[model samples]
Target: MGDGRANNPNSHSNNSSSNKPEWLEQYDVIGKIGEGTYGLVFLAKVKSNRSKPIAIKKFKQSKDGDGVSPTAIREIMLLREISHENVVKLANVHINHADMSLYLAFDYAEHDLYEIIRHHRDKVNQAINPYTVKSLLWQLLNGLNYLHSNWIVHRDLKPSNILVMGDGEEQGVVKIADFGLARIYQAPLKPLSENGVVVTIWYRAPELLLGAKHYTSAVDMWAVGCIFAELLTLKPLFQGQEVKGTPNPFQLDQLDKIFKVLGHPTQEKWPMLVNLPHWQSDLQHIQGHKYETAGLHSVVHLSHKNPAYELLSQMLEYDPRKRLTAAQALEHDYFRMEPLPGCNALVPPQPGEKVVNYPTRPVDTSTDIVGTISLQPSQPVSSGNSVSGGNPGRNGWRNKSWQHSDAARCCTASSSTAADKKERIRNGDDWIPSTTEIEALLSFLI
Candidate 1:
């Protein structure tokens, strides 16, 4: 119940406030869940009711340096403002004066899209059923649509960031998480680029790659398109190698990979293409290549004429203006087709055979309930044999035994950066590494 122990005595200095916040005693800290760029996350429960589990995200706070991380502030502000079923809920906030740490309590999500997709592709040794895929995408779109309508752009929309409810009445419901890279795009002090690189390289839109200073929520749509393709193929669509050295705005290599399949974009196709800061340099490289437009079907392996493919194409459209908005994407006939998007992403329609039992999110039992722990790289653990235990509460998955002991890891589950992960995908390696390069890039810019 009461933070297990008092705040670390050494955490407070004579000049600093030693008083612990009132909310600190309210939640029973269970154990550490996972670490991120900002700070560590812990699985916890209300002291009054142990049955109700929640996730508490502790953001890093520096001593004798800056105050709370700006990213953390932005996340708190935006999350508190937006209330939607498809979005992760922020239930409470706690400030530990002893360490100046910011803690956010949110509804705990048992699984994420990355884990689900990886389980099917590598562990389950089968494709995720179309009904499941449709359901997840629909809920994702529903959330993204709400954000866009409210003039918010989820700059970083990737598999790892999309959370899925693994149990409870909200079981299988998809909730979009990680507002660290999200931005209120209605108006801004400067061009979005002034905030440094936004989306991850793999899901990054073409305009961002070409150094488009002023951008729109369409960037998020482009990412959703990439995510849709990944869901179907169980692999990133344009898994191009990230450019090293100084953060180049042109990113010719990434563009080359996209052009190879989607074909080169011309000024005629994208009216603003020629005006981008790095457009001239990018054009120089693109002009040398005679790349033919390879339709989405060739790369994704989906039905060439299916509504899903058509929608994918629209989402991955070269021109941001032409890309399907979340609202327009939801209106696509893909959702209207047979086997309509279901309420749950994991629930099988017309149940018969048993499904794979996914493991619960790994929780590190070693970490104590110390006030505001530092962000340390956790030892990568398989989804199976997590510290908290292995039962992923899914209806069809219960009582099913797995033949293989070592289940495949999610796309970003490992310690690899997005760029390195893309390289692994290119090299045909099964081990995928996941890191938020935005934080790395922002470190350089800041």
Candidate 2:
């Protein structure tokens, strides 16, 4: 945890890149997934389980001080103990001796919410199906509720951090990942860090960016509002121009952007705005002018942006005291009146229960495809293309042939080992279905 006082003037910024550590030789690299200021994520397979694929995040250790950033280490430790369907599961962490690097293993998701929005921007603009939007929002709120119930505050709540498991039908199984900036809020005692500039710029709550020393879960609620607006318009709601030198915002300029589209808040509606730590002093100067004409055009620039525009305005209110809580937001008229489809779908049945209402399958599994094994009622299957005919009741999930393509086989040949299999399976590589198989599975689930 940070000690409240800023670190030494010479401490390295978290954004700088460092040398790759040597201990990375244990696994064979497949490809790169994404890169950020602190680390690089690689698509890798454990040597023991040639069929399994995992995403490994390799972090650069400090040379003279603590090896891994304390914030990064704290996130890993916290996530390791949390097990939720909506939260990203942390598989394992290892310290590489070669260059003293820290590697974290996690489930590899197909794409994040950001990619989905970017890809479907046109579709969303034409007319977003209320059901689909409701489903996504419900999952996002559920994930946030789980985190808050566990006392975890996801300081950074942006689209990029919310990952989707399957395509379309299986779409709403959102997993909240990237806990490097998350922290547990303890009361009565002062927080370890006072630097409120934590979340991504656009999703940042007004209080934090203005240097509020103490905050609560409401900060995250504010971010959720930003995300909700983004989902509606297929564009970011509070994105402001980035300042060059200072990390903090000098004025509430982004709030002005939001008000321009939604209309200025009146004292009667937002009585608490004047009490905010960073309330604007020049409100009278722009009070009578049409906010939209004052260089504050909406990104979509739609003429009929009514209900969505109104709801987004309320969510992005500058006053944290007036912002909607997760539970309250869940009950808003937008979600209540026109709820998204599949928001109330039956939760997946527990082990041993029959899947009675299964959706239609695209491809018949009765006929086996090359390199793919036919699933049996019950059996213990190995990674090899071949399957063992074990007792029907031995292990319920055994009959499924763990498929491995030539690409996976080649990567596994070099690092095959029992330890590697255990590590890879624990990290979620074993659960990834082949792309062809995933399409078929989507047909059954969507």
Q: Highest lDDT among the candidates is held by which one?
A: 1
Candidate 2's residue-wise lDDT over 1-446, tens digit each?
Answer: 11111121111122135222222334455666666877667766556665355677767556686767876777887887788877887776755333345668876565666866665574333434445556667777777888887788888889989876643444447788888888888652445245435787678776665556677777888787778767667878867765545645544566555566556656676575555455554445434445543222255343334555455555666567777666666666666554333532223323452222222212233322111211111222222223434456666665544554565675577467756876887898676656978778888765
In candidate 2 the C-alpha lDDT for residue 167 amounts to: 34
* lDDT, residue 369, candidate 2: 16
Best by TM-score: 1
Deviation from native of the Cα of residue 74 in model 2, angstroms = 1.8
Give the distance in Å from residue 368's predicted Cα in candidate 1 to where it truly belongs.
1.8
Clash number by candidate, in order = 0, 8
Worst 10 residues of 2 by lDDT: 368-377
The digit string of per-residue lDDT tens for model 1 on 1-446 reads 12312333333332245233445556677789989778889998777875578999888665566888888889988998999999999987765544456788898999998898888888888877888889999999999999999999999999999999987889889999999978998778667778766777888999898888888889988888889988888988888788765554456778888888798788787888888777766545766787887767978887778899999999988889988989999999999997789877788666783555777888887786564543221232322222443445555754554434433343344445777768878898796456668789888776
Badly placed stretches (over 4 Å) of model 1 are 1-22, 245-249, 371-446
